[model samples]
Target: MSKGGDGKLADAAYRTVLEKILSHELPGGSVIQERKLAEAMGVSRTPMRDALGRLEGEGLLVRLTDRLLSVRVITLQDYLHSLDVRMMIEPQAAGLAVRSLTPNDISMLRSELAALEADESPQLEGRHWRFDDLLHELLAEKSGNPFLSKLIREMRRYTKIFERQTVPPRRKPGLDDHGRILDALATGRAEKARDAMAEHIRNVRKRILDGL
Candidate 1:
């Protein structure tokens, strides 16, 4: 394969491993045997190593004492700190995005959320993450600040790792929060959107803390 083809294979490996991590198929603290994983992925060990190296650099994987790689276990402090950063940034993004988000955008999000709510299959766990990703990412991308959007996306990844591993799936409450946020955004009031996003973040923190 050409150099470009090699890079593409590594990219595919990276995404596949990342999906497994986020979905908890390869839960935090589970060891990653490179040769075994490479075999399972049906790729050469070279691409798998490159993918693992990238994940390690991203803080999603760590090398333990014996030089074994494992998924990074997110600490509570890390989770809270990420949430704090999000609270500071996401509301601003939401406010800024009010004008940018079209009515069609709002309608589409509402429909997706409704579908998620109506879904009760075992696959709902995965769909929950998807919906959450779509909503936050849309707000960030529409916020008109590339820097702010980048920050939100980076912080969200860490927070989600913790949420998926430790926190139970919060379907109804989360959907309710998203609904309020959508309602606020639909009104095209920056303050309303800001307040709604802030409240949603606070509610998430409260729920997590209360359960502890």
Candidate 2:
């Protein structure tokens, strides 16, 4: 009940660890020890344990044995598995989003995509990812289903390993894909929106798998 109590400290630990996981700073399959992590992070064991529990609950980490923890090592098969789930769910979310999304939301999404296109850094990887994430999150939220939105968020989270390690070089189609999805959503036709999203996701799945 108190701020920064066990739960709050645990949450702090969770965010710190999750950020590392998302950034791939802690690469997949890297072993994690609670006592060591707590010591490194200047946190107590309780919060550290709680944080590990939450990560495992999210399927971002795995318990290998009584005393072993490791970041989830996602294989190409794992990528396909997650992609299958996304293909099934995200297109439907996009379809439903057409009904729930406001004009303002669409405008914001357009702005984000435009920003992404304008970015010309020598290393445009992170910029590309941020914009893609924003677009997906917006679409998921607009679906008006919290469960659907959370699934999208988690799928994105777990797949960061692949995205960061192997950014498909020919990503121009991705930009166009996002634009197409947005265009379809703007038409306010659920079927069109769904079809567009399915195309985009399938394109991405191929892009990712083809590289491997």
Candidate 3:
């Protein structure tokens, strides 16, 4: 195959493996066998290896030995620390993003959340995660400062890995918090947006702590 074809395969492999990790299908500390994974995924070793390397570079995978790799195990402490960092940064990101985000963007996300709330299916967990991603990613991307945006995105990615380890995410509370955030942003007040975002993160931390 051409170099372009190889790159496409590698990209595909990367996304598939990353999704598995994020979805907890391959939970923390799960061993990754390159050859077996490649075979199971019906992809070439080269692409699978490349994908694993990328995930490792991103700190999602750790090299256990020269011949072994495993998913990074995020502890409860690590999750709390990540949340603390997010609490510091994401509110500021939301405040900054309020002016940049369009009405349509807010409306689209609101619609998605409403749909998820209305649906009573078992598949709601995945949709909740997707909506969460959409809301945070939009805020990060639109945050005026690129450095802040990058930090928020990275912190969120870490928190997400930790969040899915617990089955059936806190859906109702989370959706309600998101609604408050959207309402604050819609009012075009930076302070309100910041407060709403901070409260949302605090609520998340509280819910997790309460569960323990």
Candidate 4:
């Protein structure tokens, strides 16, 4: 059994279940059978229940009637709302990062960008998601506001569904946008960074709408 920071088995089970949900291993809208998940993860019902409750709180799962847990579906409305929130949050974060970013931070970002560029393996798609997460997380950290970083991290959970659903053709354009934002940051041009981030998110919004 997995343990929490307090070394409780329930914490580990919660993390395991959350990983599966976020990685799309569970897929959206699929009914979650607690007993089955507990058995599959080699945990007991109590720990699994604790994990499920946490997942539900994070909007990764929903509890239905009869104590059924289902993966939360990402509706178009949800996607748009998330994009709106990101547009409001990330560009400002980028602007703040421009003022506070260190050489080391830029170097780390450059490394991530190189990895993104060199990723040709089919299995590396997941790495792309992690790269995006890291980029935003870095920006949040550079913003130097713990509360803002926490909020951004929470909002980021909603983005994975859109990323997974819209990867193949849109990925390059997304990377190009990321490059522009990075360039703006490197030059210490806060306005440019903000605009670049907004443009990138707008493009994503358009792509998602185009698909639907």
Candidate 5:
């Protein structure tokens, strides 16, 4: 394969492994045998190793005894730690993003909020997470600071992968929180947007701890 093709394959391999982990296809504590996985995935060993190494760096995989590797069983503590980081940065992110947010940005966020409200698939839990992430992603990207945006993206990635939906079909408070955040942004109240975002994150943390 050409150099570019090799790089693409490595990226594809990485995404494949990440999807498996997020979907729990490779459950926590399941061994990650690179050779076997490489053969099964029909990818080169180098790329497979690269993917595994990336996952390990992301705390999704741990190198065990004798070079063994297994998925990291995410704990409530890990969840809260990630949330704690978000609480500190993301609220300020909303405040900063206010200056940069255009009417178009507000409209786009409103549309997402509307879609989230309409989403009622009880069994398709992953759908909710995608929307939830989308809502947060907009704030992170529009927050007017590339580094902060990148940090928020990184912090939220783990939460997205480990998050489980509330079964038995309950309404997500995030839907309303997101709406309120959007409202604050629409009305050009930076501090209100900031506070709303902070409150939303706090409510999320409470839900997670209560679930635990």
Candidate 6:
């Protein structure tokens, strides 16, 4: 039982560490010393070691057989692949959402959209990303499939890294795309909603790849 608890602790540690890396707090390719992290996180070396091992498995961290660990750097190919997978998944999820969405779900989405539109300051762009995440979460919930929702949430993490890196310059246009998606969803048009989401995701990929 204690071992199971330790495993859960390690998993939580892995996730927190991965978030720090994605947010650039640790930055890509930064070296990670297990002993240092274990001390910093106030856990025993065993749990910290387990956490690092899990991160390496997830491709968020790379482990050297000799014991060095570093945050994984995002390559252009990685970016493209992530975009492709998101394009394939999220629009289909949106279509599912249309068939399942409740009136209350629609109302909440509208409220989030309104909040996103009202915020225009450069500093508030991070807040916009949070709202964008909420939109995706709501869509996932409306899909009425727990497993799909979990997968979407996991996939969204990669997109979050892309957004933090590329969103500021393209913030206005991104919001416009978001507005269009919300409009389609509001009308309960599944195909339109799916197409709008696909276009929005594609535009983001183009902007990122174009070095905007």
Best by lDDT: 1
Model 1 CA lDDT for position 74: 85
lDDT of 1 by residue, 72-163 (tens): 88899999999999999999999999989998999999999999999988788889889999999999999999999989988898888888
- Shift in Å, residue 54, candidate 4: 1.3
Query: Clash number for model 2?
Result: 0
Reference-based TM-score, model 3: 0.93
Local distance difference test scores for all models:
0.91, 0.84, 0.88, 0.80, 0.79, 0.78
* Residue pairs with backbone atoms closer than 3 Å in model 1 (clashes): none
The deviation in Å at residue 114 for candidate 5 is: 1.7
Once fitted onto the true fold, the runs of candidate 3 whose alpha carbons sit more than 4 angstroms away are 1-3, 167-171
Q: Give the per-residue lDDT of model 6 (tens digit) for 1-212.
A: 35587887797778778778767778667899888888888888888888888878767787755779898777666667777888988898898899878778778877877877787787666677677788888888788888878777766766676556544545544778888888888789899999999999988887776775
Give me the runs in candidate 4 sitting further than 4 Å from their true place.
Answer: 1-8, 165-173
Model 5 clash pairs are: none
**Candidate 3 or 6, higher TM-score?**
3
Clashes of 1: 0
lDDT of 2 by residue, 67-138 (tens): 788999877777777888999999999998898888898888889888778877765767777777888888
Report model 5's TM-score to 2 decimal places. Answer: 0.86
What does the lDDT read for residue 170 in candidate 4? 42
Q: Rank the candidates by TM-score, best first.
A: 3, 1, 2, 4, 5, 6
TM-score, structure 2 vs. true = 0.89
RMSD (Cα, Å) of model 6: 2.8
Worst 10 residues of 5 by lDDT: 164-173
Please report the TM-score between candidate 6 and the true structure. Answer: 0.83
For candidate 4, lDDT tens digit of each residue in 28-113?
88899899988987878888888788888888888788678798887767777888898898899888889898778888888888
Candidate 5 regions with alpha-carbon error over 4 angstroms: 1-3, 122-124, 165-173
